[model samples]
Target chain A: MEHLLTEDLLCNQLQHSTKQLYRTGMVAQISLAISKPVSQQFACTLRVGEVGVLLAPSGAGKTSLFNAIAGINQASGFLKIGEHDTEQIELATYKRNIAYVTQTPVLFGHLSVGALLDVVSAQQARPFDIKWALEPLKLDTILHMRTLSLSGGQRQRLALLLAMIKGATLLLLDEVLTGQDPSTKLACITVIKTYLKRNQAAALIACHQLEDALALADIAFLQQQRAGIKQWQVMPISNGIHAYQQSLLNDCADTAQDQQTVCASAFLSVLHATTISHDPQLGLCEYRVAGQPCFSAYSPHISAKQSVLLVLRANRVAISKSLLPESSFVNQWQAKIVSIRPVSCQGEHGMLIDVTLVNQGALTTSQQDVVSVWITRLSYNQLHPKIGESWYLISKADAVSLSCLN
Target chain B: MSETDLQAIILTLQLASLTTVCLLLVCVPCAYFLARSRSVVKPFIETIVTLPLVLPPTVMGYYFLVLFSPNDGLGLWLRNVLGIELVFSFSGIWLVSMIYSLPFTFRPLQSAFEQLPKDLHHAAALLGFSPMKQFHLVILPAIKPALFAATTLSFAHTIGEFGAILMIGGNIPGETQVLSLALFDHVESFNSQAAEQLALLMLIFSFVVVFACQWWQTQSSQNGYVVNNHVEGL
Candidate 1:
């Protein structure tokens, strides 16, 4: 029988709210209030040598949760490492056992990379293979160089190497590969995975990019909602990419239609749709869409069939006092002046007019079609289009194209 | 050099060394306490430790004279119990030097202890090193420069002491006559050559000691053993 990969996994994981208190680490019980009222709570447990990845949108409290576990911040739960268990221990002692890698690479500016590893290993009384670690991270050439001279990605890799040298049983990495290019990120991930496997070391990493998380994670814990951190479900590696995508669709489908409309309107609403004819000069699959026609200008991830919203730069639009005759342009609409406001652009005064176009019988039908166009106050005065006056909107064919649905 | 001059220099060195050793033995725990203790009385005790640095030396000398005089109750008790008389003797000079240099020894060591990363202590504890072992292995090694600075500063400061040593023990030859006092005696007797030579020697000794300490600090920092700079994002 084929495995059932339902969209409900996404919905349940995203919508389900549960409170879990983690008392693991060196400190005592840290209660994460995971519920609708105060939901920014996340909880996950990993045995020694286990590796887990936390996938969450940016600003979803992943760093906050990591900090609490590392004993850098006060958490309302119990944490135990080794023997002495309490909310408070000598901070240095706590740090000596746990190594933290921040989103931005932080290295001692005064020390060489080699010296950093030496100091940490000496303090921990552990013999570390500095050359081996640096070689894997592609930092062997720069081991003798000053830490201050390294680039952002290089510094991040160096920080990881240092943390490993400390031999901390638990490593908490926050967006550790965020600053690296795709190739470098892939290389770093491979090194980390191999290292964890060989050493049997436990690691918890927080990442915004899904591909990186997917490539390295043994078990994925996704942050569903903003308020409560609930573990909707866990998937093993056997489920694959198809299962993940299906779970996401099911999760979206399980939400009430009204809720879906709210999310869709705010994020995925198809503001405009247009077709592009095949032109060798313009290339294949080139098209113009609605809204502001600046989607392709802003994002690089645009593709066919994916919904997009174009942010209309008001200045790029033209408004005429009379209805525009049908022409070769991509967009033309008859609209009434809803509101007019003055806006400044590059030391020049301009008027931003919000025009509402009527379609069918209802106002909501074409409300999304209503677009704002910016014209100089001088030009607006010359035309003198009153608030109640009617006019047509026009945009050049090349001014708009397909946009990525963000 | 005259017999008196040679004897005073020897006595001064002996007293300063002994006082520094004694001061370290007592000040290690005191400095550590001042650095680490969170108790409310710490400030009060620290003030008392530093009082000698600010107190008028003559006034301190007068107080010690009264306390250690043969007829005084404490003096009589010490004499009966330990067969020791502290007034007008080499021992009295040693006692006064230790008290006078307390701040010199404790302040630097205390500040150094305070500046050490608290995380190092925590790491030591997690490593199963008991508190005592942690001090010996981690805390002491980290504060080596401060300890050296404290000992040198205290020894130099005690050797140069004049007012308190003179007022309490007087300038007795081969007993209470420290170098500073003997130099004063030479000047009084119109022996400018002897007085100048002694002053020059004292200046050279202090300069060499201080310069050596500075060089050692530079070498240690270059060795990358001392973590003076903060580790970012930790």
Candidate 2:
């Protein structure tokens, strides 16, 4: 449980003019602790054998932070990687043993895939295991092909495998999972998990996919920018989910997109559930969250007893005053309102109510689940709901989008 | 052909080959630096390298003549300390050709390096390859077309050297005398047959250099095979 990277950086915000390079008088002060041994008061710690998702909008300095850690950009302040004080010692990028896979895969265009594999394998003290690493990425077939001929997804996969082969103890993956197919993305997440556990390494993955972040992040950091200043806030996965959803709302609103899409993602609530049964014939899957049974439409690829991450749009969930209803809604769970906040999306006023599921004796305090329900201003006024009051959270089975993580 | 004509052809080939090889050795690294450097003086250095391209060959030759004169300090030091003569010798003219053809060998290389993807060197470094290995395995392979063009152009320019060679090293057979000088001599003395032979040979050589560079570039683009700019081998 040792810290892998610690950074306190102060960098100039530079802008290019037609005639000169000038500082914009806005300096970025960033402090980060990657895989810290213990959670410090200020910085969020991603310990050993953990993947921390970095959630931020565009132009929020996510790539800049990655560049600083990889020594591609200059940043001056306290910095450490493992036992070395990188700032004091001045280690080169290669010597830091950190692999960075950019958004666009930066493969060696001149070398064939096989040659690149050979060269990467030779550079390691422990030779790269081709079968173990390449099989998951589906790169075994393209060994003889030139890297330039590879599709974007294939290039990303190759870049991931090559970084793994290099035995880097820390990985900086910037938007690498964007636009990937579900199966490939699942495989990539799985490979990263196994690699981290096996080597006791760590990764800081920057991604915009909230679902992927929910499935992959052991801890998450949210970056918020205001008036050209950026700040980082660390939280557990659940809070990170809420923060990310809110950020999505702001982003969509900023772009003046349709309010429905913005509001739909803004109030999304993530539930960590385990499948109890999957009826492939009926295309229905039953999962248990907070010791209560919930059903969702099932995919044939998902089996029983596997862990799944479920996303439910807040507006899709409803609040009921009575016990389990006999309505068409297939899900109704006992819960207590924890908090309520008023939200307005493009002049459509609503109330966002947060509720914690009343778990049976089978679960612990941390395992207690929180779900958000959206209701119109009329419904909020009619119900006059109070905090810690009992209610039923109801939703139809088809409203849940489920992705199996394991 | 006369024995002196044969010697002139041999001397021209030797000088071209030596100048091309040595310039490549020196200029590749220089080009890489210029392409990657952000220093304020980079433009100044680049301007200096490109100066020879715009200046007449005779002008460069005149400067070298003054610099390498026997009475000059550097020339005197070379003779008294290193025992190397710069004026009226094969070595003197070879040096002059290297300087004269500097841009031919360097400009293409610099352009190639600049056009390369910016992440290539950084990616190689993160993969634990040393700088030399990165240059050899990544930079060299990626810029094969420019390397080819630079080599052919430098060789051809040296083969056609007339003014610089004449100024620095006079027509001395088996020493400084090359094909162009020998052909110039033949024309001056009205040796029509020998002059015609030399002119035809030079024309054919020039055509081949141009044709080879064009063919290599076309093959590289058509085949999508990058290393050595050909698809024939790995």
Candidate 3:
């Protein structure tokens, strides 16, 4: 009896292995391109077990790119999944191995959750415990409930679980967590990541939010729309700042000379306003005037006016309880403390104080009305200002830069 | 009951049962293919299947008579190979009924199959079920209501068949003469009382059968299985 059981198990494992090999060989290899009238092109090759995160402005063909890969749209390029080298396979058969979760959850609605799973499992000839599957997705409570009764997030999770239950090697997810809360989104990411890791399944997710993509992406693909669809460029999160700055510089290059020159002058003026020491070891450069800390930057070349906006370093700015004496070294203003948040920077204790700046007497008018600045909690406490108290704020001349805006 | 009347009833039941069985075997696959296939030939096949639904009964009957005549190649082959003539035979009447009721059976099943979520089939494939297994296990079970409705419609339609069956079967007692034909025979023979009695029986039987089928369907649905409610293809 034991020998027979072992033989049966071995046979089942062999059958599974053969089916997987066939499926892997038959999976499509997709390359996508978007061409616009302006001749902007983006393209990328998709591989199994690789997570491709697509980020672009709305209408950037993110959805279209996925559709083309799924063979739901007409696209000009090579789309081969494994050995199947056809523009479109038999639609029904081709779609059988690919699971696509649309932006909106589309369910049969009539079948009970258990019944639906049973039918799906029976058809797939795979052993599945519907109750066990539902439990992880938090859908066990609603197994007997009507599909329409599920909330948006619940429905989204259900759709995801359904796709997972299908056991497809490739999953195409489109804005699956568009309206989910932070906790729900985190939970969903955890579920998806675990599924991908366990099954070696490749997923292509279209996302508009950076945080979500960063949370789950193993490989990040940045998509930009030009004349048409362009190839996705894999970028490292560690180089996020540099990449962002370079892209801004490229954008600035397209502006008229007058505008660029003006932006450059503004940046220069801010940089030259003051000078302060920055710690090179900490990647912290500070600009201050008359011993009053103002603005800081990660790089040594802290200039006020670059044709781009520089990131404001959190450490250099100091806060005080009362309005300090008027000084030439730093920009000063009265701001009401909104919130006090604790933070850690490079093994140093810090606090982030959200302050609403009161621009009382500045005369320069601009298209945008107000500007807000973030200060550390230590600075806010040093100022000894209460939550609603308005306190004086200031920045060194060099730290106050208009140079990078160009 | 008279011998003729009793024979007609038995013949009617047999023809309807046979037609329903044949229709299911042929139509299940045909309907599933029609529902799922995206081939270029789909529209052409659909038009052919639907021709009987719109073609006048008399026109269809004329074609059947011509097609089944012994002089025709197909008819001669059937006669020689099967030792049976289709014209003016009970088998001829069953064939006509199957053709006439094809739309009634196929449309419900087709729509039912179509209404099933394509994702379910995709899931099945990923789970490693072959095409045949998926159809039998997933597609068949999901479209059970449509199957039931199709069976009921086809059975009822076969039982009430007249023009096409008449053209092909003639009014032979104990062979081709169904209940409907039996009622017509009574009227033609000037047996008014017998004709009235048969008519009343036909009316009551038709009403009861249809109502009972419909009630069963409604009960199944109310108990939570949703029947296919989409418009049937003519």
Candidate 4:
């Protein structure tokens, strides 16, 4: 049998009808077939040790799905974890051999950090080397301290480390990086990636940071709601963030009110770029995207030739018929409008115009540097921007958010 | 104090001590079940545990007295098979005390267990601890103060028991007679001095129990032992 976890769980959000009776609040159907050792296929199935990220707005049943998979919550479904058929055998949570790190690290408070580590080491068949993470996660100094005395980030780091060391084939991490600083968050991400690769273990990490989640995930699972039912859909992320964002835009329109964050992310384009120049004195950095220069505020962390992801909000992108005199808009690109379509987002009507860089060669979908601009109904009527027309797009330096690619 | 009064005092201490031990042994499992079990009959079982708290001790003793009568089926079976005699004996009163003080010992433990971090057991299980180990290492240690509270309250409550002991054990010298019965006998015979002395001793003992429980809770809070168990729900 394949080392895989498959579930078609039906979960309900229950509310108390009176003091004793509970009425069904909402129902969600979570069906996923995740394979160990990461398989590469169409978006139909996720090859999971390559790491999958579960993305949804709050209360989309991400944690509920994790609980179901961990055998903590009972849901009616055809559930299987590796050789154990959960539907046939009532497997205990620990018996499932799945490591679950909840939002708050559930730790033994009575035990010291060292004692906790000792217990985990003694119990696990193959313990992950805590020494490898001691320095980076800053857990070395706190090893002798009691777990109850540790800060939020320290607790999260320890929890993740222990879960990895438990040597479970699957890891369910729910917002494990919430309390960490930027450097620590990067360290945790690196540590998680290293552990997964080294152990050939699959992880379904639920995080709200789209860039970080996408950077770490081979494929993304979007918990989408259609009509009254919510479902988990395998979202292909091979074409980078643009294709994924575009897919969200296309599929999440109907549920815009419930998925405000998803809709907000859909209205932005994430471009992969490399830094060309940085002037710390002037606090400005120039990046090359699709063979064009894009300028943004400087950061000490971003050096020349370092790859980065630039987030450009569609509404901030302004297009003109001709090149105009720049005031504070430091970045400008000459492009040809490829498609113009009317769209309603968050109950507001707008026109989404897709533009491609001028003079670019025949590019595949993955290589296409398409910048989407959202113009309101008033601006659409005023500009009368037509498809296949050449235009100049202007954006302020601050409008572009520079995120370092991991 | 007279020799009979001394014998009654000794017997009361022995009864309270033995009854408290038995209550702890029995109530730990009962409190654990009441705290964690989701069975359909949980409410019914909870009601039974609480019955001793609300009903008059004489009423509880009357039921047990009927149950332990030699003419009754259960009492006859015990006498025939085990050669055990419970009525008007030390064992009879000790058993009654355990039942009478059940809620005093069990309620605090149940509340503490209920207030325990919900995921503590789950965390222990995932860490490969057996269920027994989880209880010994995680659950017991977390509720140590409550354990102390339960033991002291049950001991104190058993010491104060009078009506149930009278109904079951009767007033017999050095066998089933206890301090409460001696004090009652002294007051009825117009021996005001001995009765006053026994009443004063009982008052001081009750004060000590309340002070010990309050002090234990304060110490536990100061040491952060109880604070650590109060993890916010996820």
Best by DockQ: 2
| Top candidate when judged by lDDT against the true structure | 2
> lDDT tens digits, residues B1-234, model 4?
899989998998999899888888988988888899899998888788878978998998898888988777888888898988788999999999998888888888887888788988877776656678788877888788888888888888888888988998999999998998999999999999999999999999999988878777777765435522211110
lDDT of 1 by residue, A245-273 (tens): 33343444565332221111111111344
User: Model 2, B1-234: lDDT tens per residue?
Assistant: 999999999999999999999999999999988989899999899889889878888888888888888897788889889999989999999999999888888888888788787888888877777778888877788888888888998999899999999999988989999999999999999999999999999999999988898798887654343323321210
Q: Higher lDDT: candidate 3 or 4?
A: 4
Cα displacement (angstroms), candidate 2, residue B43, comes to 2.7
**Compared with the true structure, what per-residue lDDT tens digits does model 4 show for residues A204-261?**
7788777677556765676444443455555444333455566556656756353544
Order of models, best lDDT first = 2, 4, 1, 3
Cα shift from native, residue A157, model 2 (Å): 0.9
- TM-score ranking, best first: 2, 4, 3, 1
Q: Lowest-scoring 10 consecutive residues by lDDT in candidate 1 chain A?
A: A261-270
Which ranges of candidate 1 are over 4 A from the true structure?
A1-42, A47-50, A53-131, A138-159, A166-169, A178-187, A206-406, B37-39, B117-144, B210-234
Candidate 2 ranges beyond 4 A from true positions: A1-48, A75-90, A224-231, A247-266, A299-308, A346-351, A360-364, A375-389, B71-73, B222-234
TM-score, chain B, model 4, is: 0.92
How good is the docking of model 2, by CAPRI class? Answer: acceptable
User: Candidate 3, TM-score vs. the true structure?
Assistant: 0.61
Give stretches of model 3 more than 4 Å off: A1-51, A67-100, A122-133, A146-151, A166-171, A197-202, A224-229, A237-406, B35-48, B54-56, B71-73, B111-130, B190-197, B208-234
lDDT of 4 at B103: 82
By DockQ, is 1 or 2 better? Answer: 2
The top-ranked prediction according to TM-score is 2
- Writing each residue's lDDT as its tens digit, candidate 3 over A202-274 gives 6778875544554555445554433333445555431332233234334445543312211111111111223
Residue B34 of model 4 has an lDDT of 81
Q: CA shift at B169, candidate 3, in angstroms?
A: 0.9
